[model samples]
Target: MIQHGLPTIDQAWTAQQLERNLSRVLNTGVCNKVLDALKSPNADFQVIAEMLKGDPYVATRVVGIANMVRRRDGVAIQSIQRAVQVLGLRQVSNLMLSVMLTGPLLSAEGQLPRRKDLWRWVIACGVANNYIASQLGQQTDDNPDHLVGGLILGLGAIVLWAGLGQAYHRVLGARLRPMSLNRREMMDLNVIHTQVSLWTLEAMGCPDVMGEGLRALLAGGRDETYLRYRCVEVLGARIAGLDASDASAWLADGLPRLGIDQKHVENDLGVLRSELRQIGKIFEVDLGSWESQQAFHQKIMVESGQALASLIIDHLTMQESLGISES
Candidate 1:
């Protein structure tokens, strides 16, 4: 059994341990087959359709999403092959990856607090990232692969939570802001989620573009492409009721870098949000009604405050146990 504990910053994560944790999370052979299919050059409709047919649940989801895409027509897509054709290889791949990544978490017995919220945030980021890419008129290397990339980025957090189990829950309950989690995670685990995410993707044989996009998003440097993706991710997190404040600074710095004005970015984001809601339906993610959004926002604020108080208590208890004085 894997031991769960908060490690000091000096503790290093070994390659063997990383592989063991990744295996624990992705134990199924079907997931491996799907990942293999994703990296293949000839990942055409037939290849994906055949692979998806092996898993009834995943196939049903693909058909469901395909039908959702054809909304208002009332047409039933009963065939997985037809569904693949309707959604195209890129989109079909996106849906497949989303299922593979989230299936284990969904079926797990012990529920992680706010796991649904994290998933909702994941779907939003995936959809929003693709939408932002479209708005920019830039063709992504893998087309709609940004959707998968966004989901994989969110998976990093899930991996940490699930791998560390209860100890990680303590970290989550502390309710650090989304961006702040990076620093806190580094201080506690000696490795950030982005690094964990990259390692998992590489270990799983994910495509280069996924790793590239993640690296760019995490390391917000002068790269224009990286900044664009970072902006989209930040916008998606805000929509999911995570952290909205961090995006403003990114936008302030990024828009000028892209040679675009604030009005254009705002207009694009407005259109993107509407598109996101429609896309959210296909992904089955509830970004919430306006009232719900407000309620969620309030809940997050309250929880953050409560978590900070709890953290103070935890810290004082630890200090006292270590014989440290308040001074």
Candidate 2:
């Protein structure tokens, strides 16, 4: 696996400090074992299934993806080994990584509903990114399953919340600002969550492609892989009904040289959405979780104005304390 570390001088928290914080927050005992097994050359379907059996979420999600892929028209796939066979090794690994990170962080407690909303957005993004990759793969006759980019999109937010706890909540709760989420975190926490997420993924021993895909999703480039990553990632949150104007601004720049447009997105995702629904039914995973996301956004608009005003004040005070020049 390729390792990418942040330049130490720019970081508010040193790399070691970030790791120490993440270690306390993420329950990686079972996760490390599972990922290790996934990476082992000797690991087979049965061996992988055995490793995952220890974690309820991983096991259930594995079966869910298997049945989701199967479409449930023939028969339900309940056995772990059978599930692995249906998904193939690579897809199963992708699904497992998707479930583990998204499952834990998005499950955090809150009346703010940010965690729940992020959960919905992240999962839907997994669906959307996979759809876009599949489209590109067909034309080039390459593997079409670039699913991890969408799931990793929220890694920075998840870690910020997990590591900083309520402190991160205050940052996100503040009224919508024109700044990118990265800038917001940099001002307050002296580190970018996406970078934290990238570092965390590297620390966790993720493959080079995942790390590369994340970078592409963040800054974008004209490389085919980067373009595919950007296509779904830039639009995933918007389509998922999350606030992501900062990320979506790329579509207008023509910097990445992407060709797909709004109509293309709606039409393509429409078909993929049906398949996502089928996976939800088969695996009971709620992969296409927009059912409640739209309603959540509506509720936030009506209920959050005054509350956000208070958070904005809190954020300004925090910036003052840290001497983050707002000029």
Candidate 3:
């Protein structure tokens, strides 16, 4: 049994209990059927495609990935088997496994109010990562591994929802995200959600790279891989409005520190949003909210820019009143 009311939203839970209870629930649906086939010694793309036969949602997404990514020709793939072949065995399995990790949690019985938003965040981050990574010529090991990294970026937040239910909602509902979210989780629950998320994914047999990427982020490493993950996370935060001020600061400061071209990413924003919304359809995520947030952020940026200019004018006028001059 999970602990929805282990404590009130503002209260804490013992770290020991969080671990024991969370471990019990991590053997997710992806751990069965499709994931099992992936773990099989003779795992093949055909075997994975067969496992997806009766599930139109998964099949559609398989073909969607084929059309959305693997195919540069914009030719639509209507056949799952052909989609599987185009995606290759490794790519297909990783995509299916990563998406399913947190996707099913959204539709599970007695979902939290914010689970859908979390789902949107996860998928949007993954898609944006793939888009950015591909644009930068990151091969992602010749697979859509960025999808896994994207899901991993805020995975703990979702897992905390599963472990603590509404109690987790306190953190979810807060404006803080990632490390700030981690701070609140530490303050309230005495457990870090990222650690829990990593444990849960490992228990579920997630890919080695998912663990490595997330761990690197946690350690504050500045390697190339870390920069890529960090950029995707910033994009995720902006899209989800998780930490708007921080994301805005990062945006204003420019992304060169993270090795991204701000102007290039800015130019691609339209196409990126479109592609994300299209991917959202596969998972039933309403990304229209993302657009709403986009408008809100832009408005804030304009207002802030105006305010700063006003401050400068005020300072210059005061200097003139005092008879101050540069020379």
Candidate 4:
């Protein structure tokens, strides 16, 4: 695996400080518009949606969500207006918030052709979380937590990518690709990303549960944290396009503490992987593992890290436009 350069504590602290100063950016137009819609008892849902349309990524996510809702209801939604009518207001508001929070992480760039395979794993995790939760018989109220939870379960990875930035870039270039270290171990050495993420979430006034839960999950073991981590592990492996057998093996030894039934997880792994492949097609992210997957893990780490910074800037700008301050 290639070894990426590790960021010094000072660098990590610098990233944390910069992130702390970003709250002013999050309180802008896009966030306020959504919050405003939520407060509207008789507001025009279409108009609220049109306001959100200013961000292309947000627009695409809302449209996709609207279609997802329509499909769930066995109806055809031909326009944003019709779609919002079908999804209703509260649900739409939640969808918008979810998109806003994650937009930056999802839109980063600089994946080499072969390295692009990692994103498939990320998408797989998202699909697996949704599917696994559904299979577990979660009711409507529980659905939002599960969806957001699944989507952000790998939040630690994003945190590392965003916080470590250039140092992380160097680390990956020096380590993973050069040394062939696996993704999991490579990230653990750079704990700054995780720490900074926890701080960022707290700064944003996210519930203590979200931050604590992420900490425990990333701590890596068979305890409560491990169980939560299971969701991301399964989803991530699937996203990488690994077969269930391979995924099972990877998780079994690496996450024995999770106590989740590997057999049960294996049964649905193929299905989860398939779902991720479909999402990849939708996003134009190729899912196949090229020789790059086996090369150094470090080389591409920087690329991933830098992409996150770009995403943060874009999202902060979006929030600023809405007049909603980050916590």
RMSD to true structure for each model, in Å: 13.5, 13.0, 14.5, 12.5
Model 4: CA > 4 A from native: 1-28, 36-47, 72-74, 88-90, 105-115, 140-145, 162-189, 192-197, 218-225, 242-246, 250-265, 281-327
lDDT tens readout by residue for model 4, 95-192 = 55545444334333344232233344445555655665564565533234455555555444454444444444554453223112235334546343
Give the RMSD in angstroms, all C-alphas superposed, for model 1. 13.5
**Residue pairs in steric clash, candidate 1?**
none
TM-score of each: 0.67, 0.66, 0.69, 0.60
Candidate 3's TM-score reads: 0.69
* Full-model lDDT, candidate 1: 0.57
* Best first by lDDT, ranked: 3, 1, 2, 4
Q: For model 4, where is the 10-residue window of minimal lDDT?
A: 317-326
Candidate 4 similarity to native, TM-score: 0.60
**Deviation from native of the Cα of residue 179 in model 2, angstroms:** 8.3
Q: Give the better candidate number (3 or 4) by lDDT.
A: 3
Tens-digit lDDT string for candidate 2 (1-327):
111232332234424444554343333576567777777777788887766655544566666555545543546665677767777777777766655555435344343434434444445566667666554544212222555566676666665565455666666655322135556766676666667667656655667777776676557457766666655555565444445466457554532355556556655644554433333222222323423354463343233323322322232321232211213
Q: Identify the superior model by TM-score, candidate 1 or candidate 4.
A: 1
Candidate 1 residues lying further than 4 Å off, grouped into runs, are 1-27, 31-51, 68-76, 139-143, 174-176, 217-220, 259-327
List the lowest-lDDT window of 10 residues for candidate 2.
Answer: 317-326
Alpha-carbon lDDT, every model: 0.57, 0.53, 0.58, 0.47
